[model samples]
Structure formats: structure tokens, C-alpha cells
Target chain A: MTTSAIAEALRLHPGPVDLASIETDAAPGFDGKKADGQTALADLGSELSDLQERLWAERTAGSERRVLVVLQGMDTSGKGGVLRHTIGLVDPQGVRITSFKAPTDEERAHDFLWRIEKGLPPAGYIGVFDRSHYEDVLIARVRGFAEPDEIERRYGAINEFEARLVDEGVSIIKCMLHISADEQKARLAERLANPDKHWKYNPCDIDERAFWPAYREAYETALERTSTQIAPWHVVPSDKKWFRNLAVGQLLLDTLRGLDLQWPAADFDVEAETARLIGEAPVQ
Target chain B: MTTSAIAEALRLHPGPVDLASIETDAAPGFDGKKADGQTALADLGSELSDLQERLWAERTAGSERRVLVVLQGMDTSGKGGVLRHTIGLVDPQGVRITSFKAPTDEERAHDFLWRIEKGLPPAGYIGVFDRSHYEDVLIARVRGFAEPDEIERRYGAINEFEARLVDEGVSIIKCMLHISADEQKARLAERLANPDKHWKYNPCDIDERAFWPAYREAYETALERTSTQIAPWHVVPSDKKWFRNLAVGQLLLDTLRGLDLQWPAADFDVEAETARLIGEAPVQ
Candidate 1:
């Protein structure tokens, strides 16, 4: 399949989704050759950087546009790797990475999206939320953090919030890094086995893992209810780490490419400015 | 003098600043050779773009640093041109431009800095404000829009506001686009002479021109009272537009260069991911 078709396949349709129907280990656009896939990923990375530079430039010279990438995944699903390997390929200054931990005291004082509002990438930026407001629906739902009615309200709130950002020149890319429960178990085991990764191991993560079935249900509801046309959710088959990185990277490239970005034309007389600068003293 | 030294010379010292002591027409670094100065300006533009890209990149991989360029000037002192020529060189996605006009009724309802706070640049962005919070003191003071006591409160409020932003990782570059009264009159006349430029001319601008001395006094006070070490004001001579662009461009380059930015090292095993990708099937 073409990479764009593969990217399109990753997005979840706007309705109830049976997570079982999507294969977590599938690498849809690959040719079963790692070297070629790696090479293709690298080429896409360069193209992504070039497009990002123009998008960044377009904010001042052309229409000021912005992008936000929201990644929601179960623990140990390689969210960090996707960020470092895929999104990390671009210039760091152009990307805003917000790994939303538990809400701070100040953040808890306001509406959930108040902090999200603060986190929205300004015009021309590509913002990444390591774990985003979906937590309000996911963990918040699975753990009974908010009432069902309140959780229902959040779906509408999230849809409206995303629509508002889209209205204000932000393009949202939402992805769920889908990995099988068996794969997650093995990954957790590896993290524990490697002494170097002991620091990354959280006891609460294992406890959270116990509720995997419930968490999957929560994700299904959140995805189905909140996937609007403006900001749809893409359920990326992420059991194979490399495929996950390539898919997310391709998704980002395509999103930025879709922006009608142009390097702004000079509004003044460049010839006159050139002549005048050379003729005059460097003014202070 | 070297271009850097000339750029440094434009910065106004924090204290009692007498506007007459500063020459608005002197081109400090130019050698009466438009070609060489233009070449140097072009070089600065490229350097600025490189540094800004790294700075934008650094936000995720490195320190997540950000810069704000605040331009304050008299009518026709070339703030827009500086934004277009000097700042225009960087990728627009990396730059956020906020041109502050007269506050709307809703804006007037809030504390002055409330609006300013809303416009602060996010990490990794180079934000430009054509006319900024300084307007509160400049036009407000000249027009008696605020009581003397309230204006006194604002001086302290602005200093605190700037200090808070610096603390939050934003480096502010404030410039007063300094042009002489005669230059202003000539620019206004030229605006009228060209029918194409008529849309940019406001009758209120001509009326405000009548209070030039009051405006100068107001500026001198604003510069002296609010030029914090964290956000000092640079008074760029604007009689020559080319020099103004070059000076501001050089200043931005120097500022971003000072940021200790580096590309982020990957936190995951690259070799393993590469191996896994090459070996996996193109799972559909």
C-alpha cells in the first residue's frame, strides 16, 4: 500500500470501534525489509523538516498556521520512542513537547483544558502532547475520577475545544499507539529485566496494567465519541516499534504538507534597501 | 566600528534617559557602502534563521528556550518593515507576530498587562509585537488616558511583568524605532503622496503627530522606568530603514546565539529498532 494510504488506514472511523478488529502488530506500508523501511523513514524525516521550516516561516510571511499532535497510548507502548525517533527528527525549536503528568495544584484549580489551552501550539508551531486531555476521559473514566455525566460533557467539551483551535489556525493530529496486551506485558517485563530501565518502572504502572481491559474500553469510548472530522483519532498498530515511528512520522509530514505554506514574498523594495544600506552608515 | 559593537551601542541604559542624547539619524556600523552593508544584513538574516531554528529545536531536545522581539516606535519609524525584513528571514512558523492597536472595550476592561500576558511567546518561538505593552505608558501618558497615580502603578507593573516572563524562560528584546520629527513629517507626506499607501494612513496619526514632544517625553520616561536588565530597550535609529532592519537582525542573531542549544540525543536503542523494522513483515 502507499504510505498515504497506510496513514489513512491508521485513522479510526467516526463511530464505535472494536479494538480487536485492528491488528496491533501490523506494519501496513512496509515490505518486510527493515533497511528500506528505515531509509524511507529517514527520507520522510528530511521532508518533514523542510516542510516544518516553511510552515514556521509561513506564520510571519503567509497565513499563520499551527499544528498539534496528540499521542494517547497505554504505558510501555513506545510513546517516548515515537516522540524521540519520529517527532524528534525535526528541529527542536519548532516542536513543543508537553508530557502531561498528573495535574499540578494550579492546573487542577481550573478547567482541564485551561492547561491544555496554555499548551496549544501558537501559530506555526507543531505541538506534541505526550499524554493529552484524553486522560480526562481515559484514566478519568476507568478510575472513576469524574462522574459519567461529567465524562459525557467532556466529549462535547473536547470536540468544541478542538474545533475552536482548528478555527484559530491549529491542525490537530490525534493518535492512539495501539499495542496488544501481550506485547505490553513483554515490554513491561523487559523494562524490569534491564537494570538501566529500572528508574522508568513504576509500581503504579503494573497496578494500572491490571485494569487493561477496562482501560481499553475507556479508550474505545473516548475514541468513538470524540473523533470529529476536524481532529480524528488514528489507532496506530504499534507492537512493532519501527512501524509505529514511521506511521506517526508519515502522518505528521502529510498534515504539514497539506498546509498551503509559502515563503512570504518581500513587501518592500529589496533593491532599494540593498542600495540604501551600503550607502549609509550602520545606524544605531 | 564592528557591526556587533554598533548594535550594542543602540541599547538604552536603564536610568534617566534623555532622548536628545541619542541620535536618531546616525548609522553607526554602515561605511557608506550599500552593497557591503546589504551583504552583511543578508548574512545576518541567514545566521538568524539558523540560530532560530536551533532555538526552536532546543525547546524539546535541549532547554526549550524562547525569544520575544518587542518593537516600539513613532509613526513611520519602520516597525512593520523591521518585522518584514529582519524577522521575515526566519521561518514564519517559528515567529509569532502580534500588532497591538488601540485596545478594544473588552481589552480595556482588564489590567493592561493582561493583554500583554495573552501575547507572550511559547517556548521555542521568536515572538514579535509591532507596538507592545509600552503603549500603555506612551500613548496613555501622552493622552491622559490613565491617571498619574495609575500610570505610576503601571511602571512597576510592567517591570514585574517582564521579570516574571524572563523567569518563565522568555528572553525579551525591546526596541524603540527612533526616528526624528523631520523624518516623521517626510514619511507622513510620502504616505499622502502615494494613493496606494492611503489605506495605512489614519487621520488620528496626523493628530497624534501634533503631540510629538509629549510623546518623546513619554517615551523617555517609559525607557528609563521600565528598562530592566532582563528586558532592556534598544533604541534603533530609524531615519534609515535599511540600517534599522540590519541592526535589529544582528541583535536577534546575537541574542539567539547566546542560548546554549543542542540537538537531543535519542533515549531509545536505535540499533534494535532498526533491526526489528528490517525483520518484520509488511503486516496489513
Candidate 2:
């Protein structure tokens, strides 16, 4: 069967994602023209809305199907921007967004995936995780938040958890918003330069930036270990904010359309009901 | 403060909503021209999209504000269409939609508002209820599903519940999508005539149609008892589907625009960060 060109170009096939081999500035689906790319994004936005409506209807009619978009990016990689500009194009009514910050004392008490399981989107809904369980492996590994043995066990736990979610009808689109150290510096600098952007600036972000090399190594390890056949990780280049948005949007649109969703069919009689309704006296 | 013209025209003020006084086919927010009205609806759709983003950003920045849209109407009154076309214009990532079906055994075990409280949109989100707790008063009363005394207490409970939500920063927009019996008949007939719409056809809907007068009386009683300063009811004339969509869209836009939301300001230093980023070596 013929598939969407954009999905075919961007999808990371089953295997390891070599972070160094991926370009952070690639716009494979767009012409060089900015306006043309934006127009394409707009068009895809409307299609995503339509497909989402059908998906909701399918679920309402008793179909247990769902889409979960896992966004993992370093600080200042524009996860919030993607949430606002790209996926934000679909209706908010049908989407469930979870922004996982540091686990609370109560949350930390449970097993790592405990908080995550509570936030999964129900069948027929689109769920977005601004930061997700992968944080367990990424930040925990890089920050020495967990022991080396515990980190290894988490990798195994995550794989088992995701495989079960897939078995239960969740279609996962995991995108690591990949940006270079230089790009990160520019973004953080921009945040400091603009007073309006200061609210997003945390002094600790600089502390994390100091560990750039270590974090990159941590990400490369995590991607290689977790990119499975059921839920492969797409390393989205984040140097060009616009391209990152477009690629992720197209990835989602393709995944939803691939479901071949249909507007649910009616279950009751038409002709007799029509005749009865027309023949009946006005309720007024 | 001046309110929006469309909002002013469509809002049902403090009084018992006499459904008979409302015109199910009225399009007060549109010009007489259908094409013009459709164009106007499209414009409002985009505006809703922009405002919704800002509202979400406001919430993400720690504003505890929210909007809840309650849609209560007879079957075939176009609740699903509103969800798909009007509200669907906003990004799904920020929306929380709940379509209340009959009470499941577990739900029946709890108070009526138990399920509703679980579905509310958090700060900065817009929550849409296709059908809501008012059913406890409407269907339960008309179909004798609950005792008259129990139904009466629910009205007081609903008023208190809504008042608390408002006090906690949830703005409520309750709308009764009013369609004439003839309009409903035609819609049901159209559903039957189209094979693709078959799944939406529920024979029980026709059985409920037989008790039209009781349902109307029940709705009037519910509206009169629940309409308060904090949560007013807007009886929308929904015989014309396009008009219905436009009216709801306009109401939401006006409500959100009235908030006078501001983009959050940055908290970190700009000049220093810019200098540091520009001076930094490439991590590649």
C-alpha cells in the first residue's frame, strides 16, 4: 500500500538512532521557501483536526484506539513551542496533555511508571507528554539521580511498559527534539535577552547546560536501547524551530491517517424513523 | 465594560428560559446571507484558535483560570457537530472533552457529580461536556429515573457545585441547543438516509422522542432552577446547524477575549546570556 511521503521520509526504522548522523536543520518535507512550508503546515493542521474528530467518534462508538506523542528534548529545545504551534492546531477538546515535571514526594514514593500510567490517554483521545518517563533514564542517568544498576533496570522496565501499552492499542510516536549545543546556547541566550521570556529561564538550566556532553551521551544510549519496532524514536532536528514543528506534525498526521478511521455508521432504522418524525405532530 | 455584540444577542439573561420564546432557526450572530455567515464562522474559528493558545500559555505560566462549556440538548440537536466543527478549530492538545453516556454501574454507585469532577479541565484549559450532570434533573425527572424529592435536591446541589467552580476560577458557559421537533425529525431522517451515519442511530433515541413534552418541561425546570449569576444559561436556537456552530464559537471567543490575558514576562538576565551563548564553543 502507498504511504504518506512525509512519514516515509521522517520515520526512524526499527534500530538504533545515531544522533550524530541526524541533521538538526533538515526540512525534508518542505521546499526552501518559508511561506510554502508554513502553508503546508496549515494544510496538514486541518487534516489532523479532521482525523482527530473521526478518531474520537470511533472511540465513542467503542473502539479502543489512541495516539500518544512522547516529546523528549533538552532544555530550551522548544517542546512548549511545538505544543503551541504544531500539535496545537488540532482541537483541544480531543487532546489530553501531560507536562511531567520533577516527581513530587508522593509521586516519588511509587515505582517510576506509576505516575505515567495514571496519565495515559483513554482510547480515542490524543495524549501529549511534554516530558515523559524517558526522563527516568535520561536525567537520572546524566544527573546521577539513580544508581547505575537502577538505571539499567529502568531501561528494561520502560521497554516492558511500552510494549504493554502497544499491546493494549496505543500507537506511540516518540520524538526526541534534537538540537545542537550551539543552538541550545542561542535559545537560552534569547530567553535571557528578552524580559518577556525571562519567566521561562531557570538558573538551574545553566547548570544542566554545563553537562552537555554527558547529557548527549545519555540520550544516545537511551535512544539506542528504547527504539523498538512498536515505538521507534524519531530524532527531530531542532535547529530550525519551524522545521521541527513541521516534521513532528507530519509524523502525527501520518500516524492517525494510517489508522483508516471512518465516521461511525448509524445503528437504527432510517426510513421508518424519518416517516414517523415527519408525520408526528410538532413538539411545540 | 462593553461585551461582544454576538455574545450580547445570544446570551439568555437571568430569568427562566421560555423555550417557546426562542427561535430554533435564528442566526443572530450572522448576516442574512449563508455564505457570509459561513465566512464569519471561519474567521471566529481562527480567533478561537489563537485565544485558546494564549489561555493555555497563561495557565502554563501559573494562571489558575479555566473555561467550561456545558452543552445540553435533545438527541440530533448537533452536539457532536459542535464538537467536530466549532470547538474542533482549537488545538486538541489543550482541550478536555467529556461525553457523558448513561451511568455505568460504578458511576451509579457514586453521587451524580462524581464523574463530572473527574473530567474537569485544569487551569488554563477549556473543558467541553457534550452532555452533562443536568441529565440527572432532566432525564431522571422526565423518565422517572429518580424520585421527585431527590431531583429537587439535585438542583440545589448543582447550583452550589457551579458556584464553587466559579469561585475556584472556572468560567461556565451553559448552553441548551434548542431544536424544534420538526428539525429533529428531519435530522433523524437524514441520518437514516445516509448509510455512513448508521452507527449514530440509536433506536432508544426515538423512544425518548416520544416523551418530547416531558423532556421540554424537564429542561425548563432545570434551567430555571440552575441558572445563577455565576453560571447563566444561553438557550441557543440550533435548528440551523451552521448558525448553532457560529453562536457557540462566538460565545467562547467573547468570553476568552474578555479576560484580557497577557503574555508572561521573562525572569532571567538577557545581555549576559546572549554574550555567553555567542561566545560558547560548538558542542558538536
Candidate 3:
């Protein structure tokens, strides 16, 4: 498609993300691009497929490495797309994806990470948390999931928590899927339109929407304070999903390249122990 | 790096597979051009991480779409890498990874798909089976997961089972991870020599080593009888893990892309139904 046609297609698509910013500018607060409509869906699908195979190898190899991909975004900011694109790439076993909603009664009683930690993948595994412990800092503060002082203290705790994970050999990559106000309303409205999809919508979303500025403040504070050298945050422009997905895909490739893991020394042997790990698990 | 060095590095770093001989080659084939050894640990590790991302995407998206990935392979043929790759790329919530071995008495009872289907991912999820129902046709014909005549019946039943899934909108991708006897022996020996790794060494694996040809025959027969249009079989090159990972990643990407699932479209009056779907489940 021609550039103008692509721009028009993007206009049909909701959200106003400028992806070029992801690749080039990170400073002036991501001047997001418009979606290329037809191209966005077509390309995201292809890239997702290619990435899937690489991730499967890591799962099968059962190497002593772990990858944690955390996505923190505002409502209707393309967290679902980020998830869809992220899974669009890999095999099912080594990659574990979680979308966090309201905490279970049990979850509320325990330390924030208590429920979150159970979901962390083992070595050579990748875990994606749609909304992770950062919720304790963001939603908890905005929705009163925790006390103000508690929310304030969790920032350091969040940093320490992530630092511990990185130190323990888990590669942590955090993404804040950023979208515009108009985009959020459009998405929330879209969810309100379909029947089969009706299952995904919740009225509480409106309540959350009312506190957008509060959430923004909570998010900004959570992000700035918890964002550390160990786990840097990427505020992805979700208005243009194609760009967001491409950006995420690129980031994954870059980080994977940087990790540089290998099959355990050929002579060192991995089969038995790896097999044993599976064997010892209560065989279903 | 020199051509040889590059070749050595490529050997260890898993990438695209040569599809033509994927059915025949066994081993996580190295791409690194190392004259002294196979792919380096660093390259392989990085490759695994990349593979993991791809696989994670597929797991999450495919699962949401209710896709099942079936991986079958001989000893030391690198099924593990497939697992690693597969899991690494999926959302863990939607990705269910299962490895089938000797069935327990309870599993032996009831139809094969009973246990197998239990492992089936919920609608809108991804399921990965390391060894699957085909065992009724494969090993049952060989070591007998069922009666001799039952094995004959199962081959057809297996075809229908997969066919039914496809008919019901389930996407099935079956792969036979092929490895060479030589590579298998080397890996087997490596596991045996390492004290820590000894636990992974299975005496049963050696017992099957003697019947490699028979197992091959069973695989061929099973493939011919059961490889339906809906769930076509891909014999991946086991030796070249890079290629295997690449091939699988591509295949998964292509598979999910083929489904073309749109985010369930927005539902305007979903609050009531959303509550019901979750409410139907018993609280723990």
C-alpha cells in the first residue's frame, strides 16, 4: 500500500501510537506513529511466527536461564495486543503468559509477590506478566489496593524485588504499553460492542477510567521509582499497535542476543537432570 | 570471525532448518562453523532466548485460539529444545505443556484421548504434548500402549481424533523430532558419564535404542495413516536445532497467522455475561 493509504488504514484502526519513536526517539516522550492499517496486522502476524520458533528452542533446551517479560499499561492501552503479539511468536511450554486482574482473597492476604512469584518461570523459561507486582504500586495506590504509605514503600521494594530476580540470573524486561485517552475510550467502547467478546468487559473499567489522572500519577511514580538498571521500562506507544509489536519483537531479539546462552557444554550433559526435573514432577 | 569460526558459531546457534531433510536428521544440529566443536554456548543461549520469545507468543495466542502442538521424537533427538523453544514464547496462563510417558494404571483405563484431552488447552489457549496420543499407534504397535489389534484400530481413531479437533476449529501441528543414532548415542553416553546428570539417564531409553528401526517403521506407519490434511505432520531436522527452532517458530507463526483471530471484538453489554462465565466455576 502507498504511504497515504497506509495512513488511512491506520486511521481506521483505533489508537494513535507513533512506532518510529520506539526505534528512534525515547527522550521527547515517544512521538508515536499512526498504524499502517492493513500492513500492521499482516506484518505483526509474520514477525510473531518467526519469533515463536526461537523461543521454543530455549524451552526444550532447559538451560539454566530465565526471562521475565513484564507488561504494565493503562486500561485499553493495548495490553491485550502486546500479549497477542508476544505469544504470536513462541512455543507454549517454555513461555508462560499471565494477565493479572483483581487479586484473589488469598492474593490480597499474602505479600504482593506471593501470588506473582508462584508464576515466575524456572531456568531457561520466559514469564510474561500482563500486570505484575507493579500493580501494587500503581493500581493498589490508585484503587486503594494498599495504603498510601505502603504504596510509597513498595517502590523500593519493587526495585529490590526486580534486582533480586536479575541477580538470580533472570533477565527482566518491563514494558508500559502507553496509549492516548481517546484511544482508551474507543477500545473500551469496542469491548462494549461485541457479544462473544462481552466476556472480557467489566463495568469496573469505567470506574478505573474515572481515575485516569490518579492512575497516571500512580503509574508515573511506580515507573520512575521502580524502574531500575536491572529492569528498565519501555513505554511503548500502543496507538499504533504494529509499531508497538515490532518494537517489542525487536527488543526481545536484542535482549536474547545479549543473553548469549548455549547448550550446556556438550560434554557437561543435560538430558538426565533435565529429564529428571520433568520426571520428578508429579506425572499427570 | 573467519568463515570457519562463523560456521562454527552458526552450528551452535540454532536458526532456520533445512526443511527437506528435517524428517531424517536428528539432533539439535549446530550451525556454528567451529572446526573443533559445535555451536558455542553463548550463541546457543542467545538463540534459545530468541526462540523462547517466539514460542511464548504462539503458546499464548494459539492457546487462546485452542491450538494443540504435538511433538514426538526419539531419544536424544532434541525434543527438549522444542519444549524450551515452545514454552519460552507462550503466555504461561494459556500455555499447557504436557509430556507423555508410560501411562499410569488410571491413564491406561478409558480411551487414550481421555488423558490426552484432559491436557488439551481450554478454548482460546495453546497445548503442547511432548509425546502424544499417537503413542497408541506408535509405541502401542511397537511396545503396546494398547492391544495389537487395538493399535491397528487406534491408528484410524487417532486420525479421526485429530480430524475432529480440526473440524471443531482446533489447529493441530504435529512434529516428529528426528535424530541420528550416532548423535543419540553420544548424548546418551554424555548423560551416563556425568555424576549429576546420571539421574536423567533412563535405562528404558537404552532398551528402545535396540529397536530404533522398528520405532522408525511405527512412526512412518503412523504418519501415513494419521497425517490428515487438518493436522499435517512436519518431520523436523533434529540434528540442526537452529533450523528446527527456526522451522517450528515459522510454522507456529504461520499457523496462528492463518487463524487470523481478531481481539473478540468489543461487547457493549458484557458485564452480566462476564460475571456468569467466571461465576460458573466453583470457588476454591
Candidate 4:
């Protein structure tokens, strides 16, 4: 399949999105087994690295184009895993990663998008947000952390903020890692079984599980209200970790390829510089 | 050889250091050809990943420990290469990399270390500075950006600053990537020869070549003054890119291993959390 077609297959179409209708275990567009998916991801690594370098190179030539990947998921939906396995493919030098946690007193004092605006990648970079301004709509709505009218207003605000970013040359990729409740339970159990993973376990994760339906509704409503043509959301199945990594990797690869980034032309005379370098004396 | 022993061999001892005496192309501690070094580096990737995760895990349990790698070198010394090939082995999410360029007007207004201070990694991060506060001594001295007495004071100030950081649980790995004048010319020529590499080619780099001897002397003096017991410097040969990558990777591995990090124990009852997760109802 063509790269864009593969991306389109994973992309959530505009309108209402039903959480229950999607199969969390199915590898939607990929025609492969676990090993094949791994091999494909490995191949995508080199391609992604090369494309990212071009994107970075353009920045050096004063281009403002950049990519922002916003990953949102419930606890144990493998947001961290995608960062490690998929985003890990490129040069960390060219990537800016921000994992947004609970709002600080200062962050709460500002507009929801204020901290996010500060975290945007500069010219020629890929920025990843493990959780983002979406949290204000996701967790905030579920937990009733904001006023009902305020929560209702944020959806339009987020859409406008994103549209402005797109106009300013930011390509945004939003992925909602979709996993079954059974899969989350199994993953949580594995974390409990492994002593080394104890640091990742939070009792609050269990507390959050009680509000799963509410969170799902929030996600569904958010996806419907905010999945714009400019910045669409891709609901990645996360029951199979390999598929999640592969899908996101492919999506990034397609986005980069779509940009058609070229090696920035030399503004200086290459011949003159080469001659000057050749004529320079070696240090004694 | 033990990892520490390999690290020890690459370290610059406290004494007068001569740039001319060191072979820029030699793989000092590693007994390997290019392919062998590549294999060895690939092996370090997984090991480094595991160690970094453990360090990251420590932060969740309130450990303040972190690692800072300071990279300093002349132009075309492969600092970016090490970041891509060596540091890229670990999860980018866990690594904080800052590439310092010439200071802005605001930065010039304050002490040099002020900018460096702001870039320090928080708990659980492996921070890599492509160029660091060392620039104040090296470039500032060569270019006369600061007064003689002011430059002299920075060395002592740097020692005290680094010592304080060590006391606060930051392990410093400082490396000066050493490359020969001939090697730099070749790399610069290659950049000029390739259109794709034009973005990386800077005319100022050629201008900087004229100050080689001055810069070398500045490096020697800075090394003599600031190579403290709390934060020593390693002079890694960089003409051979593979060895440079391998040596830095090994140095980072050794520093992480020295920390003796263990996964933090669970603060909550794992069994109870598991039971609660298992009993949670599936969202309709």
C-alpha cells in the first residue's frame, strides 16, 4: 500500500468516533504477523532517521516547518511504549519530547494551552507530547476539574489553537492509543508481577479505572468535536504493542514524506569555501 | 577489560596536557577494527537502555541522581555523530540534549554558567550538552570575548560549580572530542563537496580554523585548571568516528553503572491493586 493510504487507513474519519466499535487487538492496515511488523518497524527506523535529518537541515536554512506528535491514552494504553520504541528511531538531538503531568499551580494559573505553546518545537524539529492540552479536556472533563461551560468552550479553543499552529507550519499528529479494558488489566497485572516495574505503578491508576466509562465518553466526545481536517486523530490499537509502535512509526514516516523536504541549498559558494579550506595552514 | 578500566584509560590525568602528543585517530582502549567497534557499540545500546531506565525509575522514588555529559571540541569533531549513534541507543524521552550556540544578548549579560545552569537535567535524566560552559573558556579566550582576569576567574568558578553539582547527585562526564587539523579540513571539504551537506557547512567554521593554535592553548589551559576531582574531563580521539562513538558510549555506560541503581520498590500494595484492577467492570 502507498504510505498515505496506510496513514488514511489508521486515521479516524471526521464525525463521531465510537470507542467500542474498534477492535483493540486487530492490526488494522498491516498485512503481517508479529515478526513481520517488527522487521517493518526496523526498516522504517532508517527511513525516519533520514527524513528527520532533512527536516532538521531545513531549520538550519531558516525554515519554520516542524512536526508535533501528541499522544493521549488511558493508563496502561502504551503511550510511553510508543515514545520509547517508535519516536526512539530518530536522532534525539532533533526531537523535543515533553511528558505533561498534572498541572502545577503556575500552569493552572494560565490558559490551558499556555504551557503547551511554550513546549512547541522550534523550526526544523519533531516535538512529542506524551500527554498534552488534551488532558484539560480528557481528564479535566472526566474528573470535573473545570466548570461545565469552561469544558464546553475548550473544544473550540483547542481547534482554533491547532488551526493557528497549522497556519504557522506546524504539522500535528494526534494519536489516541486504544486498548481494551482486559488488555489494560493484563498489562497492570504484569507490572505488579515484576518488581522492577513497581516504580511505574500508581495506586491512582486503579482509582482512575473506576471512571473508565466516563473517560471513554470524554474521549469519544473530544475526538468527535476536535478531529479537524488540519489535525486528525489516529486511534491506534494498543492490545498488541508491536502494532502500536509500527502504526505510529508508519504515520510519522508518511507525514515526513508528505512534506517533501529537500536538502536546503547552500547559500554560500561551495567552491569558494572548499578552496579556502584547502588553502588553510595546519596548526603547528 | 572492565568498563571502568576502559573509561579510566580515556580519561585525561591531572597534569599539563599536550594536544600534539595525542593521536587523534587512535582507538586507545578498544582492541577492535571498525566493524568490531560497530558491533561493540550496538551491544552497548541495550545495556545503556536498561541502565538509563533504572536511573529514570529512581526518580519516581524521589532520587535526585542524574547524569550530565559535556561535549566540547573544535568544528567537525563529530559531536552530533555521537549524539546520534551513541546516545541514540537509549530512550530519547529519558535523555535531555541541549546544543549551545553563540550566546544571545541576554546570555552575554549574565555569567556564562547561568545558561549552563538552566540546561541541567532534572532527576532521572541523562543530559547531553553538545557544547557547554567550556565555551566560555575556549572560545571566549581565543576570541577575547571576555577579559583575561574574568576568564581566569571562570575556571575556579567552574570547579566550585561542578563540585556543588556533584554534591547534589549529578555525575558529570566531560569529553573533549579531539580531531586533527587535517581531519577537520577533510570533513569540511566533504561538506562543501556534497550539496546535501551544505546546511551544515558554515563559512565561520573556516574562519575559526585560523584560531586553531589559540584555541588549543585555551583548551590546554582550561583542562589544567578545571579538571577537578569532582568532575574530570576525558579527551576522546575523534578522527575515527566509530572509535569516538564507542568510547563515549562506553564512558556513559561506565558512569551509569557506577551509580549502582536498583528499581525503586513499590510504595503501594501490588496485590491489592492487582485485585482491584481485576474486579473493575468493563466499560459498556
Give each prediction's DockQ, rounded to 2 decimals.
Answer: 0.04, 0.47, 0.11, 0.79
CAPRI tier of model 2: acceptable
Q: How well docked is model 1, in DockQ terms?
A: 0.04
Q: How well is candidate 3 docked (DockQ)?
A: 0.11
- After superposing candidate 1 on the true structure, give the runs of residues whose Cα lies further than 4 Å from its correct spot: A1-284, B1-3, B62-64
Tens digits of per-residue lDDT, candidate 2, B33-114, equal 6677677788887778777877877875789999999999999998888887787778766677888989999999999999
Candidates 2 and 4 compared: the better one by TM-score is: 4
TM-score of chain A of each: 0.94, 0.95, 0.74, 0.98
Error of 2 at B133 (Å): 2.3
lDDT per residue (tens digit) for residues A1-284 in model 1: 22286677887776788898889999875666566667778889767877777777666555658899999999989888787568757765566777788899999889889898888777778898989999999999999988999999999999998998889898888999999877876786676555444445555655576688888889889999998888889999999888888889888887877885665554555455334434443222
Docking class of 1: incorrect
Cα lDDT of candidate 4 equals 0.91
Q: Pick the winner on TM-score between candidates 1 and 3.
A: 3
TM-score of each: 0.54, 0.90, 0.55, 0.98
TM-score of chain A, predicted model 4, versus the true chain A, to 2 decimals? 0.98
Q: Please tell me the TM-score of chain B in candidate 4 relative to the true structure's chain B.
A: 0.97
Candidate order, TM-score descending = 4, 2, 3, 1
Q: Residue B235 deviation, candidate 3, in Å?
A: 12
Clash statistics: count for each candidate: 24, 23, 114, 0
Candidate 3 residue A188 Cα shift, in angstroms, is: 2.7
- Kindly indicate the candidate among 1 and 2 with the higher DockQ: 2
Model 2 over residues A113-231: C-alpha lDDT tens digits? Answer: 99999999999888999999999998899888899999999988999999999999899999999888778877877777766556667778766787888888898889888888888
If you superpose only chain B onto the true chain B, what TM-score does each candidate give?
0.94, 0.96, 0.73, 0.97
In candidate 2, which residue ranges exceed 4 Å CA deviation?
A13-17, A29-32, A45-50, A91-93, A262-282, B29-32, B45-54, B57-62, B265-284
Q: Give candidate 4's fnat, 2 decimals.
A: 0.82
